[model samples]
Target: MTTWTYAELAPDFRYWLREGLPVGLPGVVAVSLDGGGHYARRFEDAPPALTVEATDFLLPLQPPVLYGDAQGLAVRLTDTGRAFDDCEVVFQAESPGFMLWTIHTGPLADANHVVRVPALPDGRAIRMISGVEVTCIENRDFADPTRPERTAVGASRR
Candidate 1:
């Protein structure tokens, strides 16, 4: 299994945080890591300064079920018909184990979108994205520990 250290991803994470991500949405910030790890935050209504509330996880990497990017390393879950209009689902692998994904809905669209990240089968922890420090936690920490039989050991997984 490949072990990932924060030192490797710190630069990219800091860069993303400083640039405010590449998201086109006005008040949404979304990021995903490899092994089914995804994070998203949407502000209620429209606020000048956004306070992010996020939900994230680490799960086994699954097949591309929805949308695949040009290189086939990224996949999205949004409908191809109204991708940019309503909501956006995106998952891109930055490197081998370093990946990021996003799901953003427009300001006028329904904000109740549900993102389900499968559980980590090896009982390891996944890293959380932060501007100042690097943090890692297990799937059981979130109060839900539904695990699979196999796990994908990415760079972020210890």
Candidate 2:
């Protein structure tokens, strides 16, 4: 298991996806996307700003999450503190790439969610890793406003 803390939300964060994940696998990814609302209950002194936990393969601890196979996984990180209320875990599928998971994190809205990127630059990058091997990496223009054409990973073709 690996934990991503709020402090480590910079530079880069690394986690593993299932090994031997198919390139064209459909609805093959799951994640825990929280708006850091859980941390609000932590009244203890020096409460953690944020933290995300996942298996070595990147499967969420609080499954099963949902994402349409056709959606894209877009993550946006910010320093401005904000509030994130929606939180849950489920398995989802839509198309191949439409916009599966769109993460927006900040100090105020401290977030605890899994992102699919080695280095987060503002909010524009989609990369995939199957097990210990990197399967593919693609950089898209943030201004294009076009969703990706494939989901990140999957066990087998659906």
Candidate 3:
């Protein structure tokens, strides 16, 4: 339940995917945080004089909601300011080396889900917990994407 705010369209504002990676498609998100956390994006229309791409920071009272599975773990937002119904929660397999996680959640937000990474070579150790597609993981409608291949970083979830 961490809430972070940042300018969506600012030069100084840098998120996780700073290298301009295609998170999904054209509507790729610049910032990627712990699965199911509040994200603040700056709009392009922002005034240019604004040097600091961020302002009025407000962190959530509760800490980040940690989980181990392939479900919606982060908040998803659309370019039009609308959030999707469900977002995918991609987590690193709990196993050592590269292993596939047994996911049971639908797209991530519809129902409770789980991801179990077995033991392998480069196990789920340095990977970050994240989700794709859903927005606002608070007491609201949540959705998610199921792809261990994405969250595990270098492992195959198959």
Give the distance in Å from residue 62's predicted Cα in candidate 2 to where it truly belongs: 3.7
Name every residue pair that clashes in candidate 1. 4-155, 32-100, 32-101
Error of 1 at 125 (Å): 43
What are the per-residue Cα lDDT tens digits for candidate 3 across 25-47?
Answer: 32222223354233333333332
How much does candidate 3 score in TM-score? 0.24
Q: Which ten residues in a row have the lowest lDDT in candidate 2?
A: 133-142
* Model 2 bad stretches (over 4 Å): 1-68, 74-104, 108-127, 130-158
Instruction: Give the higher-TM-score candidate: 2 or 3.
Output: 3
Q: Which stretches of candidate 3 lie over 4 Å from their true place?
A: 1-36, 48-84, 94-97, 100-109, 112-158
Clashes of each: 3, 32, 37
TM-score of each: 0.20, 0.16, 0.24
Q: Which ten residues in a row have the lowest lDDT in candidate 3?
A: 147-156
What's the lDDT for all of these models?
Answer: 0.30, 0.25, 0.29
Candidate 1 per-residue lDDT, tens place, 103-158, comes to: 34342132223333332366333332411111222321122323211112112122
